[model samples]
Target: MSFIRGKKVGGVIYYSEVENVRVNGKVVQKHIRYIGRDKDNPDHIPIEKVHFGYIATRLMQGDLSPSELFGMIEKIGSHVNRENLERIGLFYDFKKNSFSLSLYRKRLSGNQKDAEDVKKG
Candidate 1:
């Protein structure tokens, strides 16, 4: 599995995807992809550099702070609301102020194919 790794060089923090592999009878960490540095806003990483899966994971795990979460959702333009989040297999509990992956992800109710299939033999 590949995960994000961070390093500081010349006063800039660089992020990259790294993975472990065996070579020469020894296991070593290898850099998979160079994700870039956030020069201006340290808190804001380029959205293109990060995968959607990571964002979803953070949101579900409550790893992101309120401002960070809202900023990320706005930057991603993912339309994260109760209805949309639920539609995409995520749960947002307003009362508890929590986000998580839904156990009972509901399927789209008005699919044309499903309707047609039901009418056929």
Candidate 2:
């Protein structure tokens, strides 16, 4: 169950790497990945990670949407198995762009303190 639309909620996601707690609002979706043995025809499993990040280049100019962020996370979930993927949707406000691994586009940001606190209990 997700409390993204109406319910006022915030909780911790136990990813493979750093555990991250949602600060103000919960993500809009759950199980947003397509990973498995099959590359062409893949299967998705339920996964949650915190404080993870990946590198992504700015393809279009616009604000990173919640869904897009989640999808991006899912895509690279395997790479950052132990860490939160942060660079994929990480975008620069002025340039209206996102992050990238191969290209130097923007810096992926996250609140490590919050993630640690949440993991500590």
Candidate 3:
């Protein structure tokens, strides 16, 4: 399973995706992806306000289905449109009433190399 976790470095809190994987007989939390910095911090990086990591984590864990996730988004009144969703690797198909994850587009603005590494793995 995957979840969002925050780690503090140099007085700033950065968030990332962590997944529990069993290696050789022990379970360990592996770093899946870097999400973003805490916006509440003074040195926070100016990224989009959308909680992409949280949403993606929930979706990947089957905590919520795609349509249900969108419903929650609509309730929150976030300005997350198709383009923003695509940027985070979520593709919604209206005709099929489903969505897909595009690993290529999932990484944030500057994590191209990490995304490639995830693909290779």
Candidate 4:
């Protein structure tokens, strides 16, 4: 697992992957934070201040998009009238791949090149 730092915006927390780290000898896939609504005990927190573990967990899973995640909470009866805040959070999800801003950028550039190469190949 890797620990990453994210920046906070209005209300949403944005987690930018820091480094690839190992946790309990397992590789972390992704990292994220909950912005609106408490996943575990929705009633425990106020409607505006809700985000909980569930949202964070979902982000880690990479299944739900930031917008969709918040929409789900609202659909379920939670109310959050705000934009996605860019809050900084920690991320520790990496197995073999070391996650650094430079590395990530390089990989993306490489991927684009690879795609071009594939067309020529």
Off by over 4 Å in 2: 1-59, 79-119
Q: How many residue pairs of model 3 clash at the backbone?
A: 0
Give residue 68's lDDT in candidate 3 (0 to 100).
71
lDDT ranking from best candidate downward:
3, 1, 4, 2
Number of colliding residue pairs in each model: 0, 16, 0, 25
**Candidate 4 local lDDT, 1-121, one digit each (tens):** 4454656678745544445546899865554332223232211222221344455567689886857855865675755433223332323335533211100111236677688679879
Candidate with better TM-score, 2 vs 4: 4
Candidate 2 C-alpha error for residue 106, in Å: 14
Task: Estimate, for each residue in 1-121, the C-alpha lDDT of model 1 and write its tens digit.
Answer: 9987789999868877789999999999997545445322122223332444676778689786655755665676533333212222344446655444322223455685487468774
Error of 3 at 22 (Å): 1.0
Candidates 2 and 4, the one with greater lDDT? 4
Model 1: pairs clashing at backbone N, Cα or C within 3 Å:
none
Whole-model Cα lDDT per candidate? 0.53, 0.35, 0.53, 0.43
Off by over 4 Å in 3: 39-121
TM-score of every model?
0.31, 0.20, 0.33, 0.26
Off by over 4 Å in 4: 1-54, 88-121
* Overall local distance difference test of candidate 2: 0.35
